[model samples]
Target chain A: MIEDRPLIYKYLRHDKKFPHVWCGGCGIGILLGSLIRAIDHLGYTKDEVVLVSGIGCSGRLPVYVDFNTLHTTHGRALTFATGVKLAKPELKVIIIMGDGDATAIGGNHFIHAARRNLDLTAIIVNNNIYGMTGGQYSPTTPYGQRATTAVYGSVEHSFNIAQLAVCAGAVFAARGTVYHVRQLDGLIEKALLKNGFSVVEVISQCHTHYGRLNKLGNQIDMMKQQRDSAVPVEKARKMSPEEMEGKFEIGILVDREAPNYLEQYNKVRQKAKNALSLQLTKEEKEESERREALDKQ
Target chain B: MHRRKKPEPKAQLMQGNEACAEGALIAGCRFFAGYPITPASEIAEHLSYRLPQVDGTFIQMEDEIASMGAVIGGSLAGVKSMTATSGPGFSLMQENLGFACMAEVPCVVVNVMRGGPSTGLPTNPSQGDVMQARWGTHGDHPIIVLSPSSVMECFTLTVKAFNYSEKYRTPVIFLMDEVVAHMREKVVLPEPNEVTVIDRVKPSVPPEWYLPYEDTSFGVPPMGIFGEGYRYHVTGLVHDIRGFPTLRQDEIEPFLLRLFRKISIHFADIQLVESFHTEDADLVIVAYGCTFRSAHRAMVEARARGLKVGLLKLITIWPFPRRVVEPLTRAKKTLLVPEMNMGQISREVKRVNQGMTTVLTVNKIDGTMITPQEILEKIEEEKK
Candidate 1:
């Protein structure tokens, strides 16, 4: 049981807004709890943080938190969070998005934000289907999985979000599952502390939609499946791609130190200031000499 | 208390787009997000260099949609933010533009008008987006759009756009055509003391009691920026004064009505139109943006030939300036509207005229400016 429940309660808006819209046996509540614990462990106050979310079931997470939150249009959380981070570089900006919200309509912004290496953390909750819209297939829905839109089973391939983030130039990329709360909390904290674009994709269970459609059993069975299917990166490195077909590799995929966009932007500002100051000093010297000459006359 | 003396106004020969960028800087705009588009690209280019000089942030977004979203985010974070785009890019910005209206986020969007339904002409002048700027975004929402006629006006109007956006808590569109955007003219920018800058009203109440969308008598609630200690929610949904999503009719109706009433109630302050030689003229030419330049010339030429003609140049196109247009139509004379598009704004002229006067349209849509000669010929033909 959480002995520091008071500390966690300080970070939540549990007034009449209690009992959030997340379904019973939903993994989103667990993920949100882990995020709160991570931020609490990092010692970041509510005033120093901002939570931005796009439109989806997971996107509703920000409205329940006690931070400066923005619930924006679907798939645009990263874009809006980028602006918030750039505008106030001192604040810790975090984005919560669903699988469809991140990789489908918002895919362009995802790649570009990663490529720019802006200082922001994106936490993608991947339930493999559009949970808010009733069991529709999403970009992350595994091929051959049954969704409402894929009644005959999905013909399209799924995206490996952690791998996609790594290839897209994200400075920090990792995978975590809701079943492993402690590890997921650590991954989220590490991603938030990274100086550049970071993504922690948590494979959540949508027992209401994705699980029911795919006949993946109840919430407890789904949690057990996730725990069994997730292979840590160190262990997975010993196996071949063929051996890791149905299992997802957990742990950090990419963690590298690179100059973030804000650092480079600061250099640009310094250069412009130096150039402007040089021009101003030259003008000032000329004006002083002219004034001295006028006095001599 | 010692006050720093204001710097004197400096005369500079600058392009309209550059002037618009400079005006944004003067208006306390510290953040800019935009994609490169022809005619309007200079605004982004200029700001990319100028913003950093002022310790402001400038980002070249991936597309116009993200640019608009970033601008909204920046505004929510307590910085005056802006984005510039041409017609095609402006079309891409409509969805978020509506979000800004519905959420009551204050920001400026500069649409340097180019010929387009879709990339019709990138580098050509067109008033084609006048109607798009008004009604392009889905649903009925209040919007303020100010079109600049000259390079000097581009500078002044851009500042006005930011002021109006902050004052009204809504997005203000700076609609410029390619003619004014690219044209170079000697502009005497106002001294710092001469200019009146408006900042968004912030909440005077304590942080715990703050409501982001609190319904006030003036229809505009004080906006609190992120990290300012007022942690309030903001959503695109139809929300109550607390900024939370609600479907209750009473809460939703008041919220929606206030969005419209804030602009409509202040029509006197928001509506701006410049009338030239329409005092005793039987022929009144209605035009805006670059076409107004040609209309002014044609009005003078027609008057010289013993024709009673005048020009009604629209500076504030949205909210339509019906008070100014209604009286002119009551005279029962011919009203000619010429534009670079095939009768977009002319339809508005006709609609406002309500058959009180003969509304004739002289349209040119082949990526060319409507020439003074063409408008003058139309005036002569209408007289016959």
Candidate 2:
């Protein structure tokens, strides 16, 4: 079903490290496809790009990509990506994380990375449940969803990831579901092209654990649910909050230019250089004057 | 040859942390990630200002866990990287520290110690983390820990820590007590050309043939930095030569054994200790970090009183320096250990002495340095 599949295959490490661990009927493959297409569209060479991932199902995506990939500790993809971007700002750094990996254990790093406006594109796959660890409830699990950790059904509220990103001062924030392949690809490309901290939350499905435990039909039914529940931000803005209760808003929620951390840091470097040079000139002038005084004596 | 600005050779008054930061820069560290904690904050602050000037990157991570994670990432991206913290922050870094060991990622961690089981004291000197530096990370893997007795040693040992980490492909801990961290002393830093620097050995094989963790003649595989054309997997899972996770008994055993042997075989070069006046002595003071200063003074006074005494100052604390300590166990001499904590390294001393000599511990845990007079009194009382 993938058009230009041969072109996309060039971006994958299929020969050595393929047969990825994602389950069949899982939406991670579709979301990962969109991300690959986005990078491909941006014309970034494999050597010029780095994909950093944390632990979980989505975190395994970088393992299959043909870039300078880093598989880091759980809930720490953003921190690692920050280091890569700061160390070599010319490289295109992208981070892949899961719902639990991004907003739960790694929530502090997520918000701070956004607050600093680091030049990174973070894609958090929101499968609602922690799929890798036996379908436990995560921060993005809906209040009434059933998980292994929430057998009777969770009473805790789920986070609105896109809104959270905007609140954390991300220059670009967008949401797309795996069912909306074309739209998700477009959103990822825009996020990547942005020059500051960007987050694109892709609502994906884990039919094996999340669907079976919740008795949500099959994988196709889960995909249908995603398609039916997503409302464009433009339409959601015209509607009331109650109308958006059970649905999520897709499309960019925040897109604005702001000075990224590295750019500001470069300015600091320049200022320090100027100050040091000025001090050196003053010292040199005084030294020359002292030499003249010595000659006169 | 292109012209380069030469740094002037001069002795300047510098704090221990500042010297450490300078040492890291001289050792080719281009990235530093750390969370600010007392007794270790100056290292981060100095790096934050100096790293930028040197075109290096410095990041204050959200916490110590992320700090260590970032250091690993930066190191993998072909930069010498490090982080600094005190006791409470060190506790948070144990897991990632284990990841670095398991993945065989070379990085340096500077723990400027303060009193703590948990946040016990922030701005006080404590040698309490000596044991934690060795066993804090949950694993049986070997680690390198270097303790510096003075500001100059802090700089020299930090460079040594980086060299050992790069040479062995393991994490090295630069263990500094708060007394040494904050105390200012005149330090003559070696010019860049004067000091020895070791870089990670790069793979000679092509990208297609490179194995990230291949066992070679020296047991250390040549590491290829990311984006340098060699791409390979790295994980905390016990992996084989190719750096991919494995569960086979044969693969796991060889991989694990190689990691242990690489350091154990080099024990002669790894273990660094200084012996002072121990020949023909009935008493020897076993000390490390800041406590050694007091122990040295006590040994001088004890000898002045005509009691046979000496000091064995541990410059390298880990791999336990067994070769040096093993001989002391049979010398029929009293091993007096004075520490800032109740007794941490003393336990190791007693274990190594194995009842051959009386291992007496003079420990203080009141957020204060163990005075030389206190060590002298303990030696007198023991003699009586």
Candidate 3:
């Protein structure tokens, strides 16, 4: 099964650089591998691409990837990526980071980026814990989950990312867990190919810290929990509220056609250009040309 | 056949902040995100009108946070980007500032120094952010900050801000004072070709073997754009060369050192300052931001009377031109530090001087600049 990702083997320049930033038994590598697989399947030429990241343990993802990359400031990867996107609309912009990065600290950007529906794919690796800053409870940390700040269990309600993205006008939204590696890759690939804002919320695990505190213990056990708890979006949609309780959906939750923010923005721009051009008439333009011709003599 | 060389674009009297905006455009900055703030608002105002003219994007965000967010987002998308704000708003940008350092995003932030620990002065000049600009965030970090003393310098350095930001892959802070940001002056805008520009490094290696964190021959690694064919992960975590989240005991130290060294290696380009009349002067006046303009006037006054007084104007505030000050400490008998705030640059002066030179401070907190008369009086008082 690992051979399924010889694509990963070919990409691995130095196996020494790996074991990567993920903790022992961490699920981030699973999703990280899936991300690589999706890129390989799409056969993107790595040179022209740029990956921008916000702060958090997850933001570290870009440092490892070999390409034009940026590990941006906290919660500001979207802003930086937005700049890169607008500067060279020819380049592909990817924003990857943890829950703390994409949500709490970067929440304002997260909502606005979706609202604008910019042509970017934001892959949020929701490890629930702010691993880099120490396992602090983030906006996506489940209610009653024990984290560093939420040692007594989080009293705050967790956000449903897929629904929030949908409300924010993202053209595509999906949820995945490391347990569903293949499905996660497919969703990421689709999100990458999509023309507008696309978000794939990958539920990840931090075994060393998040697991110990929550009593989820060990890397492999955490992976199983995610597997058992995830209900397909379709299955959950058809199920009763009682049946849906305690089950997370893993699949493309909402995918639809929408005008990208750039196109809409460009339209406003095109209108201004046309108006300016029209203000100069064909008769006057031709007369001006004839005058220039006469002056040439 | 007499040919007129298309009237060399006439110079215009422009606001300092407006010149900064024009400078940004000339530097190839195609994305601007900023919320209007007094003094600095002219920058956003100018950008709003001009960005579209050149096919660039300008977004006025709800607040300074979103403005920085949008700026960072746009930059990562492969655009040269910037956002401008004064003290209060600059404080709001600190968290993201830390993020910018951790994530290694190249960008430019203009802090038109107003009064503050918090909302101190909206329209006044203060060098108070002198320390805040360096250690504002919560961590061990290295930052590149450039302070401009005049309207023309504001234009020139703002463009340099973008170049250094992209080259270093760090958010370069353009520290201009309220006076500098608002003061109007005649500026000759440079042609695009005449101005030096730096685009981010393209991927020199294949994507498969790419480690976004892998140190390049230049210390900084190549940056891959997001939507292009290459795909990689980026995080703010203390990780290994792979750029993934790591908890290795050995990772934190080297990671930070390299982060610090990346900028430190290019200190020559980063640390910029100018010394006028320092050659045989008995006294040296240390200043930056809007205060430098006043110091320049004071230098002329002192020199007219043959007071042997010199002025050391700081152009790059961050890697604090140590050599410039170190020599000044040994060569000069006294240093007069005049600033809008109680004493910011004064402390830096004292630190480098090692008490060898008496560091005099002409502190102003009345929401006004230290005048030439005030600085001259302070310099003469040091004589007695």
Highest-lDDT candidate: 1
lDDT of 3 by residue, B5-117 (tens): 34456598988898899999999988888888876899998887777766888887767877876776676666788999988899888877777787788889998888776
lDDT of 1 by residue, B1-384 (tens): 434444445688999999999999999999999999898999999999889988999999999999999999999999999999998899999988988999899999999988777888899888888788889999988899999999989988888999999999999999999999999999898877778899999998999888889878887999998998999888998887888888789898888989999999899999999989888998899998888898999988998999999889999999789898888999776899998888887888888888788999998888888899999999899889
All candidates in order of TM-score, best leading: 1, 2, 3
Tell me the deviation in Å of residue A48 in model 3: 5.3
Regions of model 1 farther than 4 Å from truth: A1-8, A282-297, B1-9
Which window of ten consecutive residues has the lowest lDDT sum in model 1 chain B?
B1-10
Ranking by DockQ: 1, 2, 3
TM-score for each model: 0.96, 0.95, 0.81
| Model 3 CA RMSD to the hidden true structure, in angstroms | 5.1
Docking class of 2: acceptable
Q: Is the docking of candidate 1 incorrect, acceptable, medium or high quality?
A: medium
After best superposition, candidate 1 residue B372: deviation in angstroms? 1.0
* True lDDT of residue B26, candidate 3: 93
Per-residue lDDT of candidate 2, residues A210-278 (tens digit): 999999889999999999999999999998988888998999999999999999988878776677778
lDDT of 1 by residue, A1-297 (tens): 377578667777864246789899999989888899899889988987999999999988988889999999988888888888889989999999999999998999999999999999999999999999999999999999999999999999999988999999999999999999899989999998899999999999999988899899988899999999999999999999999989998999989988999999999999988888888999889877866666666
